[model samples]
Target: SLQRALWVRNVTGCKNIHLSSKLLLEDFPTDFLRAVTCQVCDHLLADPVQSPCRHLFCRTCILKYIRALGQRCPLCTFPCAPSDLVTPAKAFLGVLQSLLLRCPREDCREAVRLESFGSHCRGHQEADEEGDGGQGQTFNSYLPVNKGG
Candidate 1:
């Protein structure tokens, strides 16, 4: 069943892969597609991570999603327990990492390193939120901070 579904998905690129056809070669249902698709980017699953509810998203994408929305599964709104979110299998991770790209942040200017990509993204987001342009500041210039004694 999984192989057939995957074959169907691959043949149609998930755009028109249907579930109800007697031939089973038509487009998949929207709900099924949504169930399998990544909510963060609305694309086909990369390193698909199955939530407790069985909804899947790209591993990295969903982690980023969780970071933005807190620890909740987007599909069923179930609490995504910290321990439940596991890194995808090494094989899947390799495939997904090869296909994924880094965010086009000029300051980041770094390739998406596989093992540390998630950390890099989180750091980048935090840095962006903190409004610190360390790249713009000169290393030799020392700014005094007022620490109240």
Candidate 2:
């Protein structure tokens, strides 16, 4: 009787359907468990990040996906700047690090260290321009003076 009641509730999509106290505790449908799972890609969240529009996805999972598409929010179409995108913090990373793997980018051989993981994944490199210019000289020094008009 309890099992049949749960089956009916699930099929009808009724949220407020009554269940006996014992049945409520015991015979909750497995479908409810599956329903709350992330719809983007069906996996348990590792360091979930909620977008401004209230969509949640794993930090590494969603960032990598967005980066491929030029850093746009997958669900809400919100524009995410390259600098605004970031990795999870230390506490969150601690929980998810083992479960969440690094981006599979071939050139990114790094394994996602906690502190510098974000910069690493983004492949942020400082431009090497310190040596570009020869010893500094004023612009006037490079120009020839014309005394005769």
Candidate 3:
């Protein structure tokens, strides 16, 4: 639950965020996952970057991978460097944000849109701090799912 709450700060690329791959909807196409997921961590992208080889990876993942492994693309083995990683197009990032993911807290089974997940997660933290223990309160994002994109 703490991790979920902290993910809100991840939007600024200030920290590492980990959302379980299991939270992803099973109906989403595999091709979509391949494009959006970090090949190193196999989780939803967080501050994602595109390699010169055209493969996508979470900015943190690629940095750690190259530091631990080598200066090569993890997916294609193409020579890559920290400079080779670039922020992806805003339109592409929006698609990743629109992907719906189920809430990870065991007590909360609500499905929330990725774009709204920050507020949804914060609701849980706030409710807990208010002594609700995330029991009776519903942490609904109320933000419409961005389906048009």
Candidate 4:
């Protein structure tokens, strides 16, 4: 029930799918990674947010950095506080959402767009629950064929 497990992990609104994993994003070129990558965690930005000084980091990462590591932006040393977080540009979100990413589970190989990954995982999760782990696969090879009819 790997699919089920993956679905459970993603119950939150956050992109817990680990889109930064190389298995999920390995197909992307290095240049593309630069645009979406969070320097603090070396992961594709999740809930990507910015500091008042405009450096980007994953929302969780920046909060952790400020709480435990330091009070300044890790990249630019600008004074940073939890309230300083801001939404990144809509144009940047567009690029991030468009990237084709793979499933985070070790078992799944479905490559999906960032925007669609949740539904993709949900389909397999539902199938696994339906006593038809094979259901998500639309080929329906198990059905009897009308041979020579």
Best by TM-score: 3
Lowest lDDT sum, 10 consecutive residues, model 3, at: 140-149
Candidate 4 C-alpha lDDT tens digits along 65-86: 6776568997888899888788
**Higher-TM-score candidate among 2 and 4?**
4
Runs in model 3 lying further than 4 Å from the true structure = 1-16, 106-108, 132-149
Residue-level lDDT for 75 in candidate 2: 64
Worst 10 residues of 4 by lDDT: 140-149
Residue-by-residue lDDT tens digits, candidate 1, 7-43: 4334333332111112112366777556544554455
Regions of model 4 farther than 4 Å from truth: 1-17, 21-29, 104-108, 132-149
- Ranking 1 against 2 by lDDT, winner: 1
Model 2 spans > 4 angstroms off: 1-36, 82-149
- What TM-score, to 2 decimals, does candidate 4 have? 0.65
- Tens digits of per-residue lDDT for model 3, 22-116: 67766666787678766766667766789998888777767767776789997789999998888899999898888878876787878887778
lDDT of each: 0.48, 0.40, 0.68, 0.63
| Ranking of all candidate structures by their lDDT, best first | 3, 4, 1, 2
lDDT of model 1, residue 91: 68
Better candidate by lDDT, 1 or 3: 3
> Tens digits of per-residue lDDT for model 2 on 5-81?
45533443222211111211124356643332232443434345656554555455455566556666766788765
